[model samples]
Target: MKIAFYGSSLVSAYWNGAATYYRGLLRSLAEKGYEITFYEPDVYDRQKYRDMEPPDWCKVVVYEGTIDALKAAARQAAEADIVVKASGVGFQDDRLLEEVLGNASPRALKIFWDVDAPATLAELKSDPDHPLRQALFKIDLVLTYGGGDPVVNAYRSVGAAECVPIYNALDPQTHHPVPEDSRFAADLGFLGNRLPDREARVEHFFLDPASRLPGRRFLLGGSGWQDKPMSSNVNYIGHVPTRDHNAFNVTPMAVLNISRASMAENGFSPATRVFEAAGAGACLITDHWEGIELFLKPDEEILVARDGQDVAALIAGLSRQSAARIGARARMRVLADHTYAHRAREVDEIFRARLGARMEAAK
Candidate 1:
């Protein structure tokens, strides 16, 4: 099958948290013998800032021009067996949504894949006419990163014709254990963009614990974090590229997973870091969130913290051997049930089912 997907930068993780997610899903799809053409806007010098080059699995097309003038690309997208418009395309997502929907082939399975399901559903509650909100029922399927009843019900209430949760999963080939790099070595490590929804959680779960252990070296990576004041024990390695994720994960004695407020509250919304940290064989300590046990067995495969005090206690008591055991178990869990190959198969089944239904309706 041929697919056309338009999303955030596939080459750069800079300011684009969805880059890893896109890569994992697309790579898996291509491995399944599907032809894919990925479209990304040439904004923010993403091509120049890219840390990884596009793989041979599919074609990468970068477009530069107004949304209206980009209709020619939409025409090409219409020819694919499936066309996807992922959430947060960096800019002009509303216009792109309208154009892509308008140009979709009558027989193609056109989908709106919402990577940030919580934020989208929450906003739709307040503004029903939120561009994409109006197009939900018209789209053949709505794929999401968040799972569980809360996320599913929210999408249904918003008039989504059908919704499926394709949660984040590990790409073992890209994220497996690697030799630690001294530049990233630390007692604690965290990589994430500094957004309003997550900054407070980072303070509560990561920074506060770092402060409690004044002698322990803590390393923070990712952009938009330099503006914040940090503790003396904390080290800031600004904007570690995607290529260094394995080294970054392994270099830390243990890595932290702090979920954004919306994702945490909704449950079953594991961020890309959770799997990446474990896939690299790094012990993980995450904040308390509902439905976490479904993914990782806390106190066994992983550790959970309620607050800064809990995090400090866990850090103080965890032994090297225990940490290594936990990391190993977590990695084993993801390798068996939570890889891109697993999720890609699920997506393929959903696409076939949706396409069949569309065919029936046409007949």
Candidate 2:
């Protein structure tokens, strides 16, 4: 099967958090004999900060930041067996959405893959005529990286023919344990791009803890926090590239996963960092949210923190041996049940079933 995926930068994780998810899922899909052409616009300085060169597993089309270029890409993409217009393309997403749905082949399976389903759902709910809401009935399927039953039900309520949550998973080859780097050594480290929805949570869960525990080093790695005030003990390493993620994960004594406001509220929305941290054998301390046990067992494979105080307490009590034990268990759990290869099989089955049903209806 040929899949044309329209998304943010697949080659850059600079300001795009979905890059790893796309890379993991599409790489696994390619291994399953699917030919994928990922179309990403050269906007948001992502092209300048690209962490990866185009890989052989799939074709990557870095189109210019112009409506004409995007339209041309859409026309080319429509010829594929499956056409995906993912959320948050960082350009004229409204136009791209319309182009994909309007120009895609009649026989092609059109999909809206929402990486941030909660925010998208909120937009749809707030506006009766949101572009996605208006187009939902026409889309063959809606796929989300997170948000379990709530997202599925919401999509169905909005006239989606079908909805599925694939969830985030680890690519062991890309994210597994690595030799710890000295520079990233910290008591608790967090890596996430600074966004408005998540900044307060980061402050509450990550920064507050750093402030309270003045002696403990809290490492923050991501873009857009260079100017953000932080405690003297807190280390702000701006824009850690994709290649350094493994070191950043392994070197930390414990890694923190703080959800965005919408994702935490919606529940069942684990950011890619959760799995990435776990895969690297980093003891993960995550803010409380629903449905975490469905992925990682709390207090065993992962530690759940309710607030900054809880995070501080967890870090204070965590010994190197304990952190290693928890991290090892987390890695083992993901390796057994949450690898991208497993996710790829699930996606393949869903795609095949949908195609089978369509063929039957046509016959």
Backbone clashes, candidate 2? 0
Q: Least lDDT summed over 10 consecutive residues: which range in candidate 2?
A: 70-79
The TM-score of predicted model 2 comes to 0.98
Q: Give the number of the best model, judged by TM-score.
A: 2
Residues 1-363 of candidate 1: C-alpha lDDT, one tens digit per residue: 889998888888888888889999889999888999988888877877998877899798878756744676677777888999999887688888888888888788989999999998988999978988888877988889866778888898989887888989899988999888999978778888899999999999888998899878899998888878889988998888888999998877788889999998888899888999889898998988998988899998889998989988888887778888999999999999899999999988887787888789989
Q: What C-alpha lDDT does candidate 1 achieve relative to the native structure?
A: 0.87
Superposed model 2: Cα runs more than 4 Å off: none
Residue clash pairs of candidate 1: none
* lDDT per residue (tens digit) for residues 36-68 in model 2: 999999998999988889989989999999999
RMSD of each: 1.3, 0.9
